[model samples]
Target: MAFLELHGLTKTFGGVPAVDELNISVETGEFLSLLGPSGCGKTTTLNMIAGFLDPSAGNIRLNNAPLHTVKPRDRGLGVVFQSYALFPHMTVSENISFGLEILKVPQGEARRRVEDVIDLVRLAGMAHRFPAQLSGGQQQRVALARALVIEPPLLLLDEPLSNLDAKLRDDMQSELRRIQRSVGTTTIMVTHDQSEAMALSDRIAVMNQGRLEQAGSPQEVYDKPASAFVSGFLGKTNLLHGRLQRGGDGIGVIDIAAHRFRASDDQTCSPGPVKLSLRPEHIRIGKDAEDHACRVSGQIHSRVFLGDRWIYDVNCVLGTLLVYGQSGAAPFEDAETVSMSWDAAKLRIVEAGHA
Candidate 1:
């Protein structure tokens, strides 16, 4: 059974529908991310799940129990917002103990819970410090501890690490994953950062304009994107437009600027226009390029050094295709002739619409 479920969920603000008929099932102990761009309704969906915003339609269930009528505080949800939402006047211990105090739990019990969570979040030595005194990453950890100390059934993180610097954000991602695994809390995070979602989630629901575009494991979502939007949004992609043709060898072929390239057959296609999705890293550049696979020759228009890899823009028969080569490999210079090819198996057949 799913740990959390949303059936036909809808939310509207004035005339704009922020979330529409969004149906999703999150497995118990799974870390799921609502991944999308700004205005894509990821946060709106999180809000609905947290009971902060009532849905315009449909029901939310936890382990098959209805949650639509539950108050936000009584819904057994722990939320960590992007802003941290720590109380400025309270010390770290007080902030972490606030929820227990609101429930009128005994002071000793609240202190014990606070101490346990502070240790769990690795903030044992900083209990007496105020939020103003803690670093951004530390403050985030405190906010996380504050939520977890209550031992809620679900945890909702709304871009929780967005406030941190780049290096700190990277550290916090790994830290968050470790803490989540240790506690095994059913988690749902909302974030626009594709890398963050890919790194942390067991599965991701890609959303756009109020609808769910696709939901799958990170590799499944990245390697076999269901739509053009997912292909471009999750990571770098080379989208080549072409028409399908059946080769005499019982294989499928795509015609790109008069060049016929072999590709794996998709039986559903009926010899029509289709788009091919290729990841930048999938395209290989070699001196002795073989023509047995899908091959195209192009001139290196530009080369960019991106830390551990080199991104090359090649002007080929299929238009400008971006190829990512490892940093220390044979460097291809600008305006140099190059052969770009990838295993036909790597190409993904996609329809035209972002649908």
Candidate 2:
């Protein structure tokens, strides 16, 4: 059995579903991220799992036992909210040891655990300081340490790093991953940031409009998105309307405007009107047409330099397509004609509309 399981888990408010029939299985010691935009039910799913909200219909199981029946405080799950939620009057040590105090752990053992977690989060010297005295990063560490001090079976983080600045958030992402790895804890984090989810999760379950759109590794979801919502949400991509014609050799040809592009026949779609998702980075600009399986001629409509890469909007025979060029490579100027090419395997047929 999976370490944690949610079968048809659901929630509703005012007769409208906030989370609908969501199912997920999490292995022991694995990190799974619930990722989506705001109001996409990611937070609601996390809340249901954390026992902060009751499920309208469904079962939550932990260790093959029913977990939904348990009260919030008795679930023994560590949760760090978006807000640190530390008691302003309590010192770091006091905050971390509070759970142990409630559990009636021996004073010596509680003190030792508190000290160990404090060191684990690298806040050894700041144990005596209150939340008001700590910086945003330090306070975040305190919240994380407090949650870890209990050593619960599951750790839940709801946008835990959202409050930190960009640099701090990056630093804390590394720190959080390291801490989770060292402890080998089963963790579920909820976040709206795609980059954050990609950087931190072993698997990502993307939600849209109270339903699960797709669940897979970062690369799997990015390369082969299940729907138009996922293809557009996970990263920058050009979604072009086309007509598909399946070939006999497990390959398909997509006709976009006046151009015909070859794509893999992996997706289950009729040979009719379809949507093709092509990542900007996959479309090579200024490449030799003789070296590629598919090629198109286009003129650069506009270009934007974003430090490490250049984004170009090219007006091709098909339409305006976005392409990415590495900063180290020569960039094309506006109105410059170039040959754009991509592998047939990189083009994907995605279902239209959101889930």
Candidate 3:
């Protein structure tokens, strides 16, 4: 059995379901991310795991023991919030030691543990500083240290880096990963930022509305999205609607307005209906076609220069498609006809849905 498990978990408010029939397992010492947009149930699921909100249905288990009946303090879980919920008057050391003190741990032991966490979070030198005296990142570190000082069996972080500036957030992402690995605590983090989840998680559980859309390694989820929504949500995608034609080689082909493209045969679609997803970077555009497969000729409708790359809106007979290429590669004038191509293997076949 996994260290943390949630079975058929759900939460409802005023006749509406915020989280529905969600099930997931987290291995001990693994870092998992609950990732989705706002109101997508990521925070609700975290709250349920932390014992703050009782589930409308199902069970939460920690270390194979039922946790729903236990009080939040007795659940052996630590949570860090987006708003650095620190005691303004207390020093960093006192803040981290508060949980231990409330639990009646020996004074010496509490001090020792506080020192350990302060060092772990790299706040050793700021131990005597109040929350207001620290930077945003430092204050957030104090919050994390406070959570981990209790030596909880599981750690939950709710967008702990959201308040920091972009550069500090990036730095803290790496720091948090290091801290988790060193401590080997089972962790679940809730975040709406896809890049942050990709950077920190061993696996990510992507939620939508109230259901888990997909769960897998970052590469698995990004390179092989299970549905159109998953593809469009994780990153930019060029969606094309078409009919399916099974080739003799077991690959499936999609018939766009004026082009036929091949995708892997992993899709469960009827021969008459299908949808294909392509990433903008996956599409290559140039005139020098020495040797390549799946090429298409189109007219360049618009081009914009973005740092490190150029974004071209192409008007192909199939429809308008976006293509991204490295800067200074080739220049195509507006209304000028051009050829675009992409690797057949890069095309992802999904069940037919709205374009």
Candidate 4:
């Protein structure tokens, strides 16, 4: 049985659905991320799961026990908010011990748990300080320690690392994953940061416009998206809109202008316009296709140096295409004509409309 199950879960405001019929099942000790942009209902779903908001329809079950009627505090869940929400007057040790005290756990056990989490998050020396005196990263650790000291069955993190700087956020991502693994807790996080989700989640559920677009391992969702919104949202992707063509043995092709790109035979493509999605990194510049590769030519219109990689904007037979490649080699000047190629297996064909 699934450890956490959300079946037909939904929420609405002003008669409009913020979270439509959504069904998902998470196994024990699994780390899952609900990833999407602002107003996409990822936060709303998290809120409902945390018992902050009541669902308009459907149920949330944990270990076969329905949670829809449970109060947030009574649900036995730990939550870390984006803001950290540490009490200004409380020191790190105090903040971490508050939950235990509220539950009337023995003072000795609470102290032991607090010390363990403080070490786990690498806040050994900072526990004596208050939130106002700690760094952003340190405060984040305090929030995490507070959540974990209770040893809840499930932990929900709502953009808990979003407030930190880029480098600090990166460090915290590693720290967060380490602590979760050590404790072997089932964690569900809501995040708009794709890199964070990909780095930390065992699986990712991509949501858009109040509905689940796709759910799979990070690489699975990135390599093969279920819709245009997912392809465009999770990372950088160039979508080429085109006409559909079916060939022998159920083979499918998407034709853009005079160029035709191969589509997987397994995809159920409708008899109409289609969109072919390709990641920028998959495209090679100044290269011809190998025997099994797909080749095309384009004129470079612009290029940007990003230290680690170069991004080139090119005009091709299909449309404007973006290519990402490693930097430090000879740069392609504007207006330079270059050949681009990718493995025929790299392209993904999706239904025309965005998800």
| Residue-by-residue lDDT tens digits, candidate 1, 134-220 | 999999999999999888889999999998999999999999999999999999999999999999999999999999999999999
Q: What is the TM-score of candidate 1? A: 0.96
Candidate RMSDs in Å, in order, are 1.7, 1.8, 1.8, 1.9
Clashing residue pairs, candidate 3?
none
Clashes of 2: 0
For each candidate, the alpha-carbon lDDT, in order, equals 0.89, 0.91, 0.88, 0.89
Per-residue C-alpha lDDT of model 3 across residues 1-355, encoded as one tens digit per residue: 9988999999999978999999999999999999999999999999988889999999998889899889998886889999978999899999999899889999989989999999999986898899989999899889999999999899999998999999999999999999999999899999999999999999999999989999999988888887787888888888878777788886777777757777655665667766778889988887665266577888888999978988989998778999897886767889987788888777887556444
Candidate 3 at 116: error in angstroms? 1.5
Off by over 4 Å in 2: 248-250, 287-290, 352-355
Q: In candidate 1, residue 333 scores what lDDT? A: 86
* Winner by TM-score between candidate 4 and candidate 2: 2
Q: Estimate each model's TM-score.
A: 0.96, 0.96, 0.94, 0.95
Alpha-carbon lDDT of model 2: 0.91
Candidate 1 local distance difference test against the native: 0.89
In candidate 2, which residue pairs get closer than 3 Å at backbone N, Cα or C atoms, i.e. clash? none
